[model samples]
Target: MDHEDSARFAFLHAAPVIGGAALLKLPPLLGALGDGLRGPLLAGSVAAFVAAYLAPRYLARHFEHRALIPFSIYCSVVGLGSLAYFAVT
Candidate 1:
């Protein structure tokens, strides 16, 4: 797929997560936390969403010409660590 298709695919995948969090998760969380904390919680959630949305774009530019070896190594370590943890547990 081209760049537009890739972006559309990313947005489609992300929509469900954002929708689920806003519709299914946020209400219960807000209720449990009470009115006093509602503003801060919502603000924090928006900030987190913005950060998550923007971070990849920023990182993509920074790593545009970099080697993928570091990322591959990091993924391997995490995957093995997870496997080990699950096997022991």
Candidate 2:
């Protein structure tokens, strides 16, 4: 792909990660704002975002192949567990 296409592709991959990080932080962020803990919360949020962004890149170096298998397994386990829980209830 050309430069612009590559950039778009990168952004497309990144969008979900960025959105997830924001969503994960949103509830606590709003609570912190209401509680007047803006400064520390904002700092912590930035640190969390940076770590989240870098973690995959760091892990990719070690798990070059089969990087997604663990995630898939975890997801499958969670899905099955949720289904079992609801069925029991």
Candidate 3:
């Protein structure tokens, strides 16, 4: 996609998370936490948010794109493993 299209896509993807943080999480977190801990909590959450947002972009940029086979295999393995474990139990 072009630059504007990419920006729009990112914004569209991010708006819900950002809006939820502002409207849902932030108010409750601020109210529940004290002044001493709020700064650290907010900073850590921002760091986590940034990492989660950028990690996929970094992986996509640096790695050869393999669509979804690896993920599907992983899910199948986990699902079968869980089924086996439950069956045994």
Q: Pick the candidate with the highest TM-score.
A: 1
Give the clash count for each candidate: 0, 0, 0
Where is the poorest 10-residue window by lDDT in model 3?
A: 59-68
Give TM-scores for every candidate, taking all chains together and pairing residue i with residue i: 0.68, 0.49, 0.51
Instruction: Name the top lDDT candidate.
Output: 1
- Best first by lDDT, ranked: 1, 2, 3
Model 2 clashing residue pairs (backbone): none
lDDT of 3 by residue, 1-89 (tens): 64344544775698688777668766666775555778887898799779867765765553444454687799999999999999999
The better-scoring model by TM-score among 1 and 2 is 1
- Cα TM-score of candidate 3: 0.51
Evaluate all candidate structures by whole-model CA lDDT and list the values in order: 0.74, 0.71, 0.71
lDDT value, candidate 2, whole model? 0.71
Residue 83 in candidate 3, Cα distance off native in Å: 6.1
Question: What is the Cα-based lDDT of residue 63 in candidate 2?
Answer: 52
Q: What does candidate 2's lDDT look like per residue over 1-89, in tens digits?
A: 54344434675688788789879877876784557767777898799778766765655454544355677799999999999999999
Q: Is candidate 1 or candidate 2 better by lDDT?
A: 1
Q: Which ten residues in a row have the lowest lDDT in candidate 1?
A: 1-10
Q: What is candidate 1's CA lDDT for residue 3?
A: 40
